[model samples]
Target: MNILGILRDGTGKMAVGASVAAFVAATCLAALPARADDVTWTMATHAGGHWLEHGAQGFADKVALYTEGRVKINVAQPGALGSPLTTTQTVKDGIAEAATTWGGHVQGIDKTGAIVGGWPGGLRPEEWFFWVYEDGGLDLIKQWRMEKFGVVSIPCDTGETEIFLHSHKPVRTIEDFKGLRVRTSGAWAEIAAKLGASTVVIPGDEAFSALERGVVDALEWAGPGQNFKSAFHTIAKYIITPGVHYASGLTECIINKDAWDKLSEHDKVMVEVAGRLNLYESYARYGELDIAGWAKLKEAAASGNNEFIKLDDSFIAAAQKASNDWADEQAGNNEWFKKVLESQRATLDKLETWDEFRLPIGGVRE
Candidate 1:
């Protein structure tokens, strides 16, 4: 009879009882007129910054506006609920109703997380969005979430290409990476390890202090704008260009499946529209901010305090090879990962010919 107690019980012995209780609760809630008028959800996020917070808050605002205040989402960032790595599970466990998170943080739970979140040598943001919107990627993501985490997820935001690394020493070549201590996560960490670097998986919040204290010799964060906001330039003199590890970032808005299913069809559609709007606005904002951040970095470089170095082509080629090998090994072990990778590669292959000619027309040259 006690709904919360049954839902919170850890033992599987109460599974049937809990299900019955949940169904009853849902039925009761649906009958209450006030329930429809006062729906609200809380979303947990990893860090607080323009790159993430703006989009998250924007989504919340749009959802509220679209639903005419019928539904509200409270955004909590800087790991208020838990670290980024744990937020997905928090949503899945019903401790939180929703989360705005990087998919890679949940890679341990589902390999598809890494692929959707942003894989090493992965598609660019536009290509990723194309795959998700037009090439069945969204359906695959939904299936993966339902099967792996008991959640529903949608792509809510896309981030620009990230800076490769912020380091105390220049990492110009593959050999230069040997013996370096780097802070990264998911497949990129695996690739870094293959390059003979010691890789540590630490929360983004801890990266600044870790690099400043010499705990990590190098680290990669979101991108130029975010790094500038975090004052990474002050801590590391070398700013590496072209984030080969993760070409573009994808942030997902995840909701517990039960919670999602409880929503009215109209409300559900509103949430989806809000997510799409957030995706567009977030990427555009990042572009504007990144340009401003780059100007500051250029100024610092001119002052001889900071230097931006492009990683050698040979090093990129080698890292790409390593990334491919890792992906192939993962595909051999996980069917879902294999499926997602195959889908992504197919999408990329189809785009390659178009890109070869399209990219050269008005592409910026150094």
Candidate 2:
């Protein structure tokens, strides 16, 4: 028998085959087929930035390191695999193994899922993580995912909730909000309207162009992490800090039911562990990354071309009050909404107390 042919046919040919032929065959097998340990999974996200890249790619790196390179992940950014609108279905259909997408875009398929993931002024990262991991919010999010979206929702980072207002004109207070056309999405759009601002709901990719063309006077994207990539620094001369209107926002890593089912018990556990770890890291990193973005803002301001505004207590209180009222109204419209609100509030009370105690410098009211 030809040595090469024999090597190809036998499972244990490393002993009998010549070293060179065995190496060639091994290379061929490695490239052509996957062993039980050699698994490659693809994950998709809507936004492209160093922050997201690190959070996601960092997770993959840790997974490979932990699993000894047995499991690998390929990260796809910005509709590379599919639109956020279809990412849930894309993953469910096995078009992609996993995805990290904004909840609002998928609200049509699962409104409850979006609310639980992150509604405007929703669960803060610290509180949300405690509620999910220590309390019971994770199970609740998962239940809604299975029941409504037929996917697996892993609550990842709450990326800094610094909902900045980047606008052509300075917005010092609520009075400046009148007749201002702002670009927004999800429940926040309603908040904008109630504040007496006209809102244009456009795909995020089109936001910068719209802002540049003077289509919208104000734009409210999350933090400097995402805003920098959009280059809002160049066009929008003013940025308002401390997003009181939306206390929390969620960026979730979701997996197809079928794909999740294929993960072995141990592998599934690894994914869950890595997800939670990265989620924690993301919260910490948000401050660091946003600070870097702030440096850029400062540079622009120093040049006498732009300005950054810090929202006062009154502004934040007003935004939060409006948001709370909306949440209450939503609950009135849907019984399930009330249940979620109660679950979150109940969980928040416990987490906030524990967090305050843990930090010690902060006071806790119990």
Candidate 3:
């Protein structure tokens, strides 16, 4: 009745889905272990709501099917293990076997981690996939994690939602940013700061309350898709964008190095297969639903529930220039910053055609 035996009895064999052969090569170094019974682990996220309900559940389901239930992961959304910041530590210290963590959310430990999620004008999904999966970006991130945190990361899922300003009052131009307190994160906050807004890093949960209490006059949360999910639309009437940012937010399904090592070859393969499938599925799913979300936003705007605002050409130019300059400044001191930016840019160049075709895949083709 040991866990491994239960796992093996539960999931008799490991099977790959349609895509595993294309991405990973089987190796004797990490061979399948003798089945004992069962293997169970916990997966944690910051938002245990719809995002994980649909997105992370896709990973959980595949693990169950691919491993035949031998390897079962109980999915926890909404900081079940702890805050997003603590999830990094939880996985590393084996407090939780696996977790969904974002780089920006853990600046207390590694300030650079947030850069993977979104940058001012960073890579889109196609370029991001090529850079991380094909162009050694994933390897580099793994090395960085090992060097700094002792956690092993798998690219779980990623999708871009437009970064826009939701404000109590209409903010139509750069001038409107002046003296306003706005909620933002990482480089976007710096971009807002450069444009004259004072930026605060509030947890996503507090954003609405901050706006309601006038703690922040505006906020650039995710696109209409997530804003609706988070219910920010109920508080803020103006949703403005110069298409200023997009979050190809990476959620790492990281496992403790030791626990990862203990996984049976069969279980390990199942994890990898599940990770890849989850990434593709979540990315594709977000791309699909977000289009409808935008349409819903437009309909709401028409009905006077919300106002969709766009940045003028001049404001976009100024914001882009400011963001680029800020990135350059950070690059001089942050080697990883330079490395990721260059890798992303180079990959974007190579996938110029893929980007062209992939645009419609995720309707955030700005």
Summarize candidate 3's per-residue lDDT along 130-230 as a digit string, tens digits: 67766878877778787788988777777665657888877766787688788887667767788998999876767888998889888876656777676
Model 1, 1-366: lDDT tens digits are 222232233563323333533543354335433336557898888656873577778778877865668889888876788776787888988878888878788887666678788977688877876687668888898898888878888778888888999999999998999999999987898888998999999998899999999999999987888888899899899999889999887788889888888887656766775676677678778888888888888888899999989999999899999999989988998999999999999999889788557755345798
Q: How many backbone clashes does every candidate have?
A: 0, 1, 18
Query: TM-score of model 1 relative to the true fold?
Result: 0.87
lDDT of 2 at 244: 64
lDDT of 2 at 250: 70
Ranking by TM-score: 1, 3, 2
Ranking the candidates on lDDT from highest down gives: 1, 3, 2
| Candidate 2 lDDT tens digits, 1-366 | 122232233464322224423443454334433336567889877666643576667677655654446678888876788775566777777888877766676655534544665666677666666566656677777787677678898765666775558889877677877899998877777777898889988767778899999999988876776777678978888887777655666777888887777666555655665565567667777767777877877787899988878867776677778877887887786665677777888876666567555655336768
Alpha carbon lDDT at 285, candidate 1: 88
- The lowest-lDDT stretch of 10 consecutive residues in candidate 1 is 1-10
Q: TM-scores of all models?
A: 0.87, 0.80, 0.84
Best by TM-score: 1
Alpha-carbon RMSD, each predicted model: 10.7, 11.4, 6.4
